[model samples]
Target: MKILWFSNIKLTETQMSGSGTWISGMNDLLSTYYPDVQIANVTIAKVDTVREEIVRGRSQWVLPKKTTAGDMDLFVKIIDSYHPDIIQIWGTEFFWATIPFETICPNVPVILDMQGFYSSVLDVLYGDLTMQEIIRCFSIKEFLRPSSSLIALSRRLHKSVNREEEVIRKYKIISVQSNWVKGNVNLLNPKATIYETRIALRPQFFQAVKWNLNRMEPYTIFSTASMIEPTKGSFTLLKAFREVKRLLPQTKLLFAGSIQTGIRKSGYMRLMEQFIYLNGLSDSISFLGSLNTDDLIKAYLHSNVFVNPSYAESYSLILAESTYLGVPTVATYAGAMGELGSSKSLLYFSKYDYRACASKIISILTNRELAVKLSIQSITFSEKKHDPKTVAETQFSIYRSVLGQLNK
Candidate 1:
């Protein structure tokens, strides 16, 4: 089967975010796990003629118009030429809105895989009259016209988009994923199918030599993720660590991942600078900038614990990756993180409670036996469920199921 994947995130080396990372993994999965299946990834890149071509091809705006056009045209051209069995739309806003669905092979099924449908709902719910009208254009017809199936990464996202009666009727399958498996599907007029998909660990990640257990040093609490402003709760993590440092001066905190540009610089970095200066934690805290897949694995291997204090998320890839690597996790109850399984293996606090989050970190830090137990469970959970092999097979099943429905 030939699959065409569309996303706005840059799939190249320069891009750094969850969506980009996922896109990269999708390509790898298609190439390695399902070699028989042909996959073409179409990402938006800006370069003049390609932008115009994409605009003409009905591509929707995902990012700023500078470097995303080439990727858009590539998608349209590939669809016209290869006529793939599946056209999968991953992420939102990036796929050009103007791309005429009817022109891209009438019957080819379009699968909308969403991490957050709330963006659309929020836009409609809170936007001005013009914004509401623009969204309405996509609401009743254009958006629904192309998709045969809709895939939401979480139930919250499903709820966000599934409210519209017209949307409910137009799509055939709607699914949401927990860490383990797909949930039930509702196939009414605005038919719905709920499926579960985990953020599976890639094979390349496992290839890294396991950390030398014997060489384990003082536990370092760490977190690595996109540096988005809202919901990431980097500030909470830092403040919590500050509290942790107050109790245990020897403990170290490391912040990894890139600084997101446009979103206000309210993430961990700025918070770290302030917290360190005000409380004098410069020596205790460290910032490890963006890391590639390999470096990330190394960070996970070396760290004693991982903390993600995001205010909201569909599911934190960082939390999943940390758990998979067997590092004890410290996270807030945001997104589908609680669904990560086994509270015993993780230390979670309320979404905005930094003091409680810090206390939990301190709990594990001071107790060696408990930390060891948590680490073992974290590793076990990650490998057993989230290994790339399992994810590939499961996704293949979903793809096949959608294809079967399309064929019928």
Candidate 2:
């Protein structure tokens, strides 16, 4: 079966990142495991590497990101050329990605892959940062820049949320990853048919370095997001870390992205910079900027615990990675983590409650036996859910089912 994919990232790049890595992995997997299911990808990225059907086994059209009517028309031509049995749009997060809806791909069956809505995140974008904290973090210079200003960011996100909601409501079929997403999707468009599916992680995560207690830094904590935005819950994590340090003085917090000196940071990050020094956590926090998968796995292995402080998530891929590798995890009961940790796979606390967050982290740190038990449970669940074979099969079946329903 010919399947056309509309993606936000150029998938075949040497340095794969985030959701793109898993999508490319699944594309390759579907070809090998289900040989009949052929795939093609059209990505919106800075690079322009356009290959046709004959040039590559499957066409990968990388269009320079544009949201014009002309771009949509050209996309139509590409779709006509490929003539896929089904068109799968990866996410509803971007304006460029909203092109291949039912209106554009009228004749074919299109399934919107539900990858967390910015509309849902828009509400918690400040990530539990109170008005007083906001007043403290406010900067006239940063606000003057327009792009990094808190007001400007909110306006842009509001626009994004409106577009995302419209796109989702128009699409009839969607693939949901978690209960949180399913709930949100129903609210946006209750008439839409929702299929629950699991995302496959990159191959490296499945077979990479495992997190063991023996190699862990005594009190090191790892977080995948550098808290580039408030939605990532950096402020929440930082508040929790302060409390954690007061109790366990040796504790260290490590961020995946660079929060280094001599860098222009976001409004939230600018606040983070001030808070770190104000709290005397200069030595306790470290940043590793832009990690490839290998380095990321290493960081995860070396840390004592993994924390996902996101106020919301469709599914935290790193959370999955950490759990899959049996790394002890603590997360807020926001978004899907509650459902994710329902099996007692990981520990949880109330969202935005730094004290509860600290308490949960402390529980994991102090009880080696409980940590090991949580790790094993998480590993057991993750092994089945993210098992490459299961993931590939589930998606392929969804495609087949989508096609089957069209006939009915």
Candidate 3:
């Protein structure tokens, strides 16, 4: 079987957005596992490496004018040349992706991997966009029409929107990560199947050096995620860290992220610097700018605690990565993050309360024995649920099942 993997964003080796990571990983895994299946991807050029196929198009967020219809028409021709049995679209909101599939490849089953609610995501990514632009950014005109199937990253996300109400009569499935998706899917669409696609740790990540070194410092806390400003809750983390610093002067807090000046300057970064300077924490507070994955793993290993303070999270991949690195995490109870933590997996804190948040960080930092115990349990949890080999196998099974259904 041949598949045409349609990406919503330009995916390049160096540019690793969450959706881009998922797309590239899926492409590689599908190609590796399904020997008989061939896959071609439609993507924007990330670099000048291969000028082989350039489909000049405009992005709503990046470009000033609507992409020429002629350019998109050429894109369809390129896709048709691939002759795919199925078309798997990564982002559901972009009309450009759906238009060609609907008009040109109607019989070819298309799967919409609604990575997340695009409307909510747009607001998070581009707060400067007007309400009208936000509405235009994620119009459901294309997806609301009947499609072969719709896959949501989380069940709560599926229920959060009203699109299912309009499309369920024709919608085949809305799969989530674990059993939690099944209950919500049944409630949302009694006819829909609740499926699991587990998140995994890449084997390459295992090569990170593990530091089980004993430290004399009473507490060292660390947090890491994409540097995007609105959604990551860096503000909440900074506030909490400020409190922790006040209570325990000896404690060190490190904020690490992969962001440069051009991208959305995390408002928190500047504010954090001010807070550090104002509070005289320049000695204890460190802003470790983005590191390679191996270095990130080292950060996880060396720190006594990990924290994810995002306002919303589908799954805190950083928390999972930290768990696999045998580090305890303190995460907010947001979105699918609750699944990542058990009573023993990591500490949980209310979303906004700085005092409660600081308390949890302090408790984990001070209790060395408890931290070690949580680390062991967290690693076990990660191996069972977030192991890459396990996740790849689960996804491969789903691909086969979907293909089988299409054949029928």
Model 2 score (lDDT)? 0.79
lDDT of 3: 0.59
Cα RMSD, each candidate: 9.7, 2.3, 8.9
Task: Tell me the number of clashing residue pairs for each predicted model.
Answer: 29, 0, 1
Q: For model 2, how does the per-residue alpha-carbon lDDT over 1-408 read when each residue is reduced to its tens digit?
A: 899888775666454765557677677677667978878887766645544432136678766654443466777888888899998888876554566445767779888898887876878867787787665555644655766666667898899888888888888888988888999889989999999988878878876766777878768889976556788888888989999999999999999965534435566777787889999998999888778888888888888889998888778887888998989998877787776655478888777888888888888888888778888898888888788888889998999999899889
lDDT of 3 at 130: 44
User: Which ten residues in a row are the worst by lDDT in model 1?
Assistant: 145-154
Report the lDDT tens digits of candidate 3 across residue range 1-408.
676665655534452433345555554455465556666665543343323332221111111134432455555665567667776665444443334445666677666444544334433443232454333332232134322111222233444454433442234544465444344445556776435676645444555544352742347888874433436666567678788888777888777866545223333344445556887777886778876656666677778788887766656667778877777678887667788869787888877666778888988877778888887888788778765566667876766787788778
Segments in model 1 whose C-alpha atoms lie over 4 Å from true places? 9-19, 51-76, 96-103, 117-171, 179-190, 210-213, 225-228, 260-272
* Candidate 2: 10-residue stretch with minimal lDDT: 47-56
Q: Per-residue lDDT tens digits of candidate 1, residues 220-333?
A: 887863333324666667678778887888888777876533233432234345557888878886778777677778887777677887765566677777777677778877
Give the lDDT of residue 316 in candidate 2.
81
Model 3 regions more than 4 Å off: 8-19, 31-35, 46-72, 93-100, 118-175, 178-194, 209-218, 225-228, 258-269
